[model samples]
Target: MKLISLLFIILLRFDGTTASLVKESSDKNTVYVCGSGKGKRYHLNENCRGLKSCSAKTIKTTREQAQKEGKTLCGWED
Candidate 1:
């Protein structure tokens, strides 16, 4: 029973740590920018330049949405 409990705790900790790492990596990869005459936008992996800066938000969305919203903004192709 003790070994089982210990294993469970270790597994839980591992899972939580991995989850946080993934989230951090995702945020690091995401970027946002604004155009000279455009509005704010987000990009996954692109060099963006504009008046506005970029950041990561708690709200989650799909890549399609990011591309759609950031169309006016700038981004790196690969």
Candidate 2:
């Protein structure tokens, strides 16, 4: 089972699909985002510069929840 998982990961990397894998894995990780209607980004760190401009309340949630709300990764996250 472990070998299969490893092979799947390797194949995902070879095909440049690691982003999906990473996202899938990080779905459960805590992320921060603005709670306003205009909010459209998720930050791995609560103090990310991207959240500085947010006038609404900052909320912490799972990355998956943020994505479900149409939020993308904050530009500053890179």
What TM-score, computed on C-alpha atoms, does each candidate reach?
A: 0.29, 0.61
Q: Best candidate, TM-score-wise?
A: 2
Q: Clashes in each model (backbone N, CA, C under 3 Å)?
A: 1, 0
C-alpha lDDT score of every prediction, in listed order:
0.48, 0.82
**After superposition, candidate 2 runs with Cα above 4 Å error:** 1-28
Best by lDDT: 2
Candidate 1: residue 40 lDDT (0-100) = 46
Candidate 1 structure quality by residue, lDDT tens digits, 1-78: 999988866676579875564555567545444333244445443333432253432233445655666453343333
In angstroms, how far off is 11's CA in candidate 1? Answer: 8.7
- Candidate 2 per-residue lDDT, tens place, 1-78, comes to 999998877777766566565655566588889878688889887778999999999998998888999989998886
